[model samples]
Target: MRFKSLRKSNQVFIFAALLFAGLYYGAGLLVPLTFAVFFAALVLPVIYWLEKKTGIGKPFSSFLGTLLIFIGIGILLFFFVQQLGVFLQDIIESKDQIISYLRKVQLKAADVTGFSLQEQNKLLEESIMELLNMTQTYVSGILTGITGLVLNFLLVLILMFLVLLNRDKFEKFLMMYIKPERQEETKEVIQEARKVAYKYLWGRLQVMTILAALYLVLFTAYDLRHTGLLILFGALITIIPYIGPFISGTLPILFLIIFGGTVEEIISFTILIAIVQLIESYVLEPIIIGSEVEQSPLFIILAIILGGMLWGPAGFILFVPIFSMLKIVFDHTKGLEPVGYLLGNERPGSKENLMEKIKRKIGRKN
Candidate 1:
């Protein structure tokens, strides 16, 4: 019986590996579908509310919700593109200033390292060339895929609409497929997953709004050029975990240096950003997001890395919620609770904590 159980466990592992391989290889299809599903989940409450509030059928409400989402996305894209154009124009005009700054930095480095200025200049030139090559390659790749990107976006919209429309049916189907005895547990798991997704997404939106306001006010007070654009970029990038703040902070600093910001201004802005980040991490996150999804820090980091490898930036943002939902499911399902615990945060009274508490209690008793 033990051998049979081991064999079954191996089969499950192999099956899971194969499923992940398929998802990776078929990302062109899966990425959009995954996005659509998540979006549908996020907006499901809106769809239901509209249906009840207006006495409209599911189809009309779903369509209305999807259309609203599309309009919002369109407006966001328009603003992003407009800001990007202006930023690019500024960069083009500042080329000479950028070159001068690079030369100054190169000279300082040469003095510190005792390398000849000529060698330093040569190294800087090579680095710039490599960076330009990379930028050109990335732009060319994006241009080549513009048509496919549009089609995939359209597909996501359609899928989101359909999913929202048939959401009840889908839930029913899932419940019906489960064994009769387990149906209630399965329903409970599904409800918990929805709660997790809804709370996390809503909390994140609140956090982003607060961050954007903070950034906008700070940037404006500092008299930064392109204040709105910088705030937008900073707020959007902060959605990615751990490394996102560094990237967001670095971009604005680079922009300032190239656009003739004073050293004091740069330092002051950096300090402001660091202070705001600390506030966000400690005050805002706790007050707003709370501990909605209690995945461990290690698991969260691994999920971010794996997500970036699979689906680029979008994956980085989406994977946290996705994994949290999976963790919820694992916690509810038989034979999967151990895996769920492994993914969970080390909370108070966890095994390690419990053992420590026991030791302390015994000492007190003695």
Candidate 2:
């Protein structure tokens, strides 16, 4: 009986490994729809809860919640556009001075690094133009994309409503396949998976808000070029996790240096970026994600890169959460529990470091 159980377990594990492998590769093909569905899952819960609490009915509450969401999105987009326009106008007004500053910075770079600044500028300009041109190439396709976007939006909204409306039915559908003894465990897993998604969305916003304020203050105090833009950049880009901080921080530093920054000023900027990321990674992410979440820096980086490689920047944003959700599911299953352990935050040190610090402080006081 023991051997039979062991063999069954091993067989289940093998099947799960193959299943996930297919899903991982299939993600490349399904990212757009997957992301739309992912966002739906995030938004639907609140809409569902509100409807239940107030007896507002599914149709009206969903309509109201979706209207509010769209309105909020419009406001944010409007605000972003207005800010960007003003920032660009300021940059244009300072174009002559900006050019002069960049020239000086270029000459300085040549002196320090023995490179041709003109060549570097030409390369940067060409790269930017090339990317823009590539986007322009997709202009005709963009019309089709917009149409698809609208269709997808409607689909997601409908799906969300249906999912919420039939939440119990969906649970029953899944639970039907499982043994009676394991039905409760299966339900618990679904609940926990949703919580992971919710935690990521909420916690990410909180972390981004903190970083945005810090970047805004730092840039404004220092009189950095395009301060408003940099702040917006910091706020938006940080959502991408591992690569976001570097990209957000790097562009500003590069721009500053290209406009003739002192080495000390450059160092200050670098240090600030470093400190912010250290706090974000070592302090904030750990605190917010807690023991319930398990992800490594390396895996996060890989996920982002693979996501980007597959589906541009949007892919980078979605990849971690999608994989994390899968990890949660895999961990809960008896056969794939070991694989979950491998993927999850099992490090004793990073979490323990915080406790040890507290321990040392108490010992000192005694």
For candidate 2, give the lDDT: 0.70
TM-score of each: 0.87, 0.73
- Distance from true position, residue 357, model 1, in Å? 22
Model 2 lDDT per residue over 1-366, tens place: 999999999998999888656656775446545654555556666777887788897667756655655565456555655666665455446555656775676687788988888786886546655654564445435443655655655665555555545656777888889999998888888888888777777677777778788888777766787676677767778888757877877888876775567889989988987887788777876666554555766777878887777666667888888778878898888789886766776765644545466678999999
Among these predicted structures, which one has the highest TM-score? 1
- On residues 1-366, what C-alpha lDDT tens digit does candidate 1 reach at each position? 999999999999999899878868888777888888877877888887887888999889889878977887677666765676676566556566777887887777878988888987777777775775565566456555656766877899999898888888999988878999998888889888988887777777788789989988887887778777787778777777777777777877776776667779989988888898887776676566666576788988999998888887778988888899999998888899999888888676543333355578999999
Candidate 1 minimal-lDDT segment of 10 residues? 349-358
Residue runs of model 1 more than 4 Å from their true location after superposition: 106-116, 129-147, 349-366
Clashing pairs in 2: 294-345
Q: Return the lDDT, model 2, position 60.
A: 78
- TM match of model 2 to true structure: 0.73
TM-score of 1: 0.87
